[model samples]
Target chain A: MSQFSDPDATGPMAQGVAIFGEFVENAQGVTATVAVIGKKNEPLYLRLFDEYQTKELYFQSLVFVSLDVIDECVERKAMQQDMYLGFLCPIDEYQIYGYMTNSMIKFVVVLADVHRLQDFELRDFFQKVHAAYVEYLLNPFAPLDGDKIKSARFDAAIERHVATILERPPPAPGPGAKA
Target chain B: MSASANARLGEQIWQKMPKINAEFFTLTYGAMVVQLMRDLEDVQLVNEKLEKMGHSIGCRLIDEFLAKSGINNCNEFAETADVIAKVAFKMFLGVSVEVASWNDEKTSCSLLVYDNPLTDFVELPPNINLYYSNVLCGVIRGALEMVQLRVECYFVRDTLRGDDVNEIRLELKEHIKDEMAEEYRRE
Candidate 1:
C-alpha cells in the first residue's frame, strides 16, 4: 500500500492520491470537517462530523488556514473556469479540498487519511453542498452580507450531505490490485 | 373569455416563465415573514409591512402580467374576477383560485385559495395571530388599482387559522375615471 508521505505533493499527484485502493475497507469510520467562508474570508459555517467533533477548534483553524491556498488557486487563470479546486494543501493527517461559487463564497472539506474518495465523488459532494447553500440564500432572512449562517435547515442539509459521503461505497479495485 | 380558455392561458404562461425551486421560494417567504415578526414585534405591523411590500411587487408585476398575457381589458367586474382567479393567480403562483360568493350587485366576491404555496411549510404558533398570506390581498388590490379599479381586498379566512380554505374578500368601491383628463378639460 502506498502512503501519502510527501505533503508537498499538492499538485496533480496529490489529487490522484485516492488511487490507494487498499484503504477502502477501513473507510467507514472516516471523519469529515466542512466549512463555508464568505467573500471577505469570514467563517460563515463550520461543521465537524463523528470523531472530529472533539477537535472543533483545531479543525476551525485548519479551515481558516486553507483559505490562503484557496485564494491562490482562485487567482490562477486556468483554475478560474472550474469551481472545484481539487486537493488543497495537506495538514497533519487530514487532506483539504476546496470549492468556490460564482459569488466568491468558499467551501472547504477536510477528510481523515484512512478514506479513499475519487475526484468525481468529491465534486459531487461539493455540488450537493452548493445546492443546499443556494436554497439557504434564497431565504429572505439569510443576509447577503458576511453574517454567519445560523439556520437549522441549512445545518440539517449539510449534515445529510456529510452522512452520504461517509456511507458511500468504496471504489472498486483496479486491474492491477493484488487479490 | 371562457374559464377553460383562461386556465389554458395561465398554464401556457406558467410554462413560459422562468422558474425556481418551489421549496426555495416557500422557505424564503417563510423566513422573511419570521424576520418581519421578530423585527416589528407586532403581528399586525408585520402583516401590514408584508402587504405594503406585496403592493410594490404588484405594481410592477401588473406590467408583466399585461405584457405576457396580452390582455387589453376586462369589460365587466365579473370578467375581471374570472381573469384574476383563473389566469393571474395561476400565472404567478402556479395555483388557480375559485371565484365565488358574488352578491346580487356583483360588486363584491371572495377568491378561495385552496393551496397556498407561501404556507406550505409553515405552522403558526398558538400565541401568534397573523395573516401569513395577507400579501396576496395587497397584490390584488394594487394590481386592480393600476387598472382604474378601486377595490378593497382583505383576508376573510386563512388556512393557518384553521379555516377550510383561504378566502380573500374583494369589494369594488368605484371605477376610477380619467381624473387627469377631466381636470385638463375643466381648466
Candidate 2:
C-alpha cells in the first residue's frame, strides 16, 4: 500500500523495518529522528513526531532545519540560545521553535514552552540539542523521525558522533590480510 | 546621553549600566555570594559587611542615574525614592518595585521578587541577621535614607523554603528635615 513497501522499488527497501529497529534501540523511552523539509514547511523525509507516540523526553518538541532557513528565520525572530548556533521563530499554535543550521543541514526544534528555561539553562540545553542533531545526521539507516530525538542523551550522542567524524582518521586494513 | 552612532562615552556607560548584561552579572555574583556564605562560619558579621558594601555601591549608582536621565532634581522625598528603586534596580539587578505606601513624610516600597540570581537555592539560617542577600535591602535603605528618609526593610520570606516565591518588603519610615543631626548621633 505505502510506497515504502512497493515490491518493484529498486535498491534497499523495507516496511516496518525502521519501526522494529526503533522498538529495540529506544528502550529508555528516548528516540531521535530526522527529516528533510520542502517548501511551505512541508516535511519531505521521515518524520518522528508522527510515528512514536509513547516515548517522552524533556525537550518534547524540537525541529531541525537547514542553515539557510535558519538565516531567514533569524531575520524575523530571536535566537533562543547564543551559545548554540540556532535561530528561533514563534509559531502561534506551537508556542516556540528553535531553527538550527550548520554547513550540512537545517534543523527546526519546536517546544511546548521555553520561557521556563533561564538564559544559561537554555544555552546549555540548546548546545546538547545541537550535538544530537549531528549524531542523527551521521547514522545512515537511523530513521529520520523528524522530531523524535528529544532526549539529552540523543544530543550527547550527536556530540560524540561529531567528535568522531571530525577526529577519526580513515580506516586502515585489518590484520594485513587484504592488499 | 548622546544619540550619535560614534558616541564612545555614551556607549561605554550604556554597557557598564549592568542591565545590558544583568543576567550574567547576577548569576556570577549570586554564585559567589552563595559560595561565600556556605564556606564562611560567621554569617552575622558577613551579612553586615555585605550590607555596608551595598550601601557604597548604591551611592555611586545614584550618580550614574542622574547623569543618564538628565533629571534636574527630585521634587519630594517620595519622588527621590521612586527614582532610586526604579532606575537603580532596573540598571543593576534587572528588577522593578511596587510602592505599597507613600505619604508626604515617609514611604514604603516592596521589591516583588521575580527571578533573582542572589535568591537561588538560598536558605535563611534560623537567625534573622544571617541573611546574605540582605545586602540588596541595605542598598535600597542606605541609599535613600542618606538623603533624609527613614527606611525599614526586610525579607518577606526565606527563599530556601522551596514552596513560596520570594518577596523583599521595604518600609520607608518617615522624613527627617535635619539628616545631619541623626548622622551625628550615630557617628
Candidate 3:
C-alpha cells in the first residue's frame, strides 16, 4: 500500500528513460526491438537486449557509435520535430529510432522493418516505455550502478504496455487512398 | 508550484512513498551484507560493490528527486546540500539530516545523518576500513555529479564503526561543463 500522500498524477516526463537494451520479438521471428538512452561523449548508460546472442562487446560498441550519430544530428539542429522521426537507421536489417530530450538524454530504438511498426505506433511505444521508466526511477530501493534495467516492475509494465499497443487495431486507410 | 505542477508532484510522491516495514528494510540490508561476505569473503570488496551499486542508484534516482521536488534547478552548492539533507532525506528516509562543517568558502561541508535508516542496527566487526555505510558516500557523490557539481564525498566517521558521530565529508572540485561539441567531435 502507498503511504501518506495526496491524490497523485504525473506523466512519463516525470520519469527519465528505460530499456537501453535490444531484443527481438522472437528468435523465430525476423524482427527485434532495441532501445538506448545515454550521454554522447561521457560513458553514461547504454543497454542492449539482444535476442540474437550477439557479442556483448560488439553491442556496446554499436551503442556508442549510435550515440555519436544521434549527437551529431542534434548538434547540427537537424532534429526538427522528433529525434526518432529525424534519424531512423537501417543497419544490416535493423532500423533505428532516436529520441533526444532537451536535457541531452538521448533515447534510441531499433527493429527490422519486416516487423514494420508505423511512426505513430512507434511513438506510442516510446511513450509507454517512458512511463515504465518513470515507475522504475521512483523506486527508492532500485540500485543505480549497472546499465541494465533490473526492475521486474518495469519489465512487466513495458510488456503490458507494448502488448496493449501492438494488440490494438491499425488505423483506417486515409481518404486520399480512395482510388 | 502551479496547480498542474503540484498535482504532478503529489502523484510522484504518492508512487514513491510506499509503506515499508522498517524491520524488513533493516533485515534486507543485513542480508545483503551477509550474502556479499559469503560470496566474496572480503569486506573491502563488499564495501566497494556496495558503493558502486549505490552510485548507480544515485545516478538514476536524482532525476526523480529533481522532478518530484518541483523547485526547478538548485542554484548553489550550499543550496543543493540543504535540499538533499532536508527534502531528499525527509522524503525518502523520513529522517532529518544536519548539514554542517562548511568551509569558509562554503565549497566544502560535512553532513551528519543522525538517524540513518540503512545503518539503524548495524554493528560492524573490528575493521577500521569497513565503511559500513560507504554506499551513502557513493550516493552523494553520484547524485551530486549529475547536477554538474563534482565533489569528493567520503566518511570521516561512522557510528557503526564506534565513532561518536556519523559524518560524511564533501569537498567541491571544479564544476562540470555540459557535454559539448568539441568533446563529442573527439569521441
Candidate 4:
C-alpha cells in the first residue's frame, strides 16, 4: 500500500509521466527518468538524458513546460467547449502520445508494443495507473517536477498513494455506538 | 425557475450593445491589480485598491445583473447567489457559477471557466502563494456588504486545468437583502 501506488492521482502532466514511467519500469524493468522542462515546447522525452538521471533544469531550460499549454489555449482564444484534458508523453523515435481524459479521466491505454504483454490487461493497467496519478496530485504535496524531483511534494505524493491503497470504508454500526 | 422569468433571463443586453469583450475586461482587471501591486508597496494598499476597484465594478454590474435576470430584489442569500452565478458572472465572463460546499464557517462558490482569457500565459511566479484573478470575489463581497450582506469572499479552487480554478466563496451570516432597502428608507 505505498502512497505513490496510485499513479492517476497525480495531476494531469505528472500522471502522464508516472504512467509512462511505471509502464517502462514494469515492462522494460527500468526506473522512470524525470526532468524539469519549461512551457516553450510540448512534453517530450529528453533523449540526451537517461531515464534515471537527475538534473536541475531552470525555468527556461527545457522548452514546453507546464505553462505553455495555458498559453497556447489563451493565444488561440479557444472556446470553453473546446477545453481538453490529456497528457503529453513522448515514447520513442520522436513519437509522443497525448492522452486525453475520458469522461472518468481514464486513459484509453493504446499499445505501442502488442507482442510484449496482454494488450487488454496492459491498457487497463495504464488506465489504473493514470487514475492513481491523478489521486496523487490531489494530495497537494506531490512534487511538480517539470524536469527532476527535488522537493518534498513528490515524496508526499507517494506516501498519500500508499495510504489510499490501505484505506477502507468504516464499518456500519450494528446496534448503537451512540447508546 | 419560472418560465417567463427564465425566458427573460436568457437575453444578453450587453452582448448586443457595443460593450467591452470579456477578455478585454478580465485582462484589464488583472493588469490593473498587478500594476497596483507594483506601485503600492504594501499589502493593505493593494487590498484597499482592489476593493475599491471591485466596488466600482459591482455598482454597475449589479444593476446589469438584476436587469438581465429580471430579479429586481433578492429576498434570500440563496437567491442572491443564484443571480450572481446565473446572471452576473455569466453575462460578464461567459462562465457559469457554481456554489461549492464549505469546509468551515467560510462559504464558497466557483465561477466555472470553460475558457478564461485572464489566465492566458499567466505563469504565476513560483514565490506567490496564489494568483489574484479572484479580486472579483473581493469586489462582489465589498459591494454586496455595502448593500448590507456581510460576505467573506475567497478563492476555493480555480477551474483552470493544471492551475486551480478561481473560486470566490461568499459566507453569509444573515439575510441583508432587506437592509439595503431599509437603509434607503431611512435616508
- Model 4 interface CAPRI class: incorrect
Candidate 2: regions farther than 4 A off: A1-179, B1-23, B72-78, B101-106, B117-132, B158-160, B174-187
Clashing pairs in 1: none
Error of 2 at B137 (Å): 0.9
RMSD of each: 11.8, 18.6, 23.0, 14.2
Q: What is candidate 2's lDDT per residue for B1-187, written digit by digit as tens?
A: 1123113433444467645454455456555565666566476766766777777776665566667755445666556545544555555555554444444445555556555656532334333355656778777767666566667777775454332445667675776599568899998
Model 2 chain A weakest lDDT span, ten residues long: A170-179
What DockQ would you assign to candidate 2? Answer: 0.02
Report chain A TM-scores, every model: 0.74, 0.35, 0.58, 0.28
Off by over 4 Å in 3: A1-179, B1-16, B181-187
Name the lDDT of candidate 2: 0.47
Q: Which candidate is the best by DockQ?
A: 1
Highest-lDDT candidate: 1
At residue A123, candidate 4 shows an lDDT of: 41
Q: Give the lowest summed-lDDT range of ten residues in model 1 chain B.
A: B120-129
Docking class of 1: incorrect
lDDT of 1 by residue, B1-187 (tens): 8888888998899899888899878887888898898899999999899889888888888999999998778889988998999889999999989999999999999999999988864556555679998889889988988999989989999876667799999999999897898999999
DockQ of the candidate models in sequence: 0.08, 0.02, 0.01, 0.03
Candidate 1 segments exceeding 4 Å error: A1-30, A75-79, A168-179, B1-6, B12-43, B49-83, B91-94, B98-133, B141-187
When 3 and 4 are scored with TM-score, the better candidate is: 3
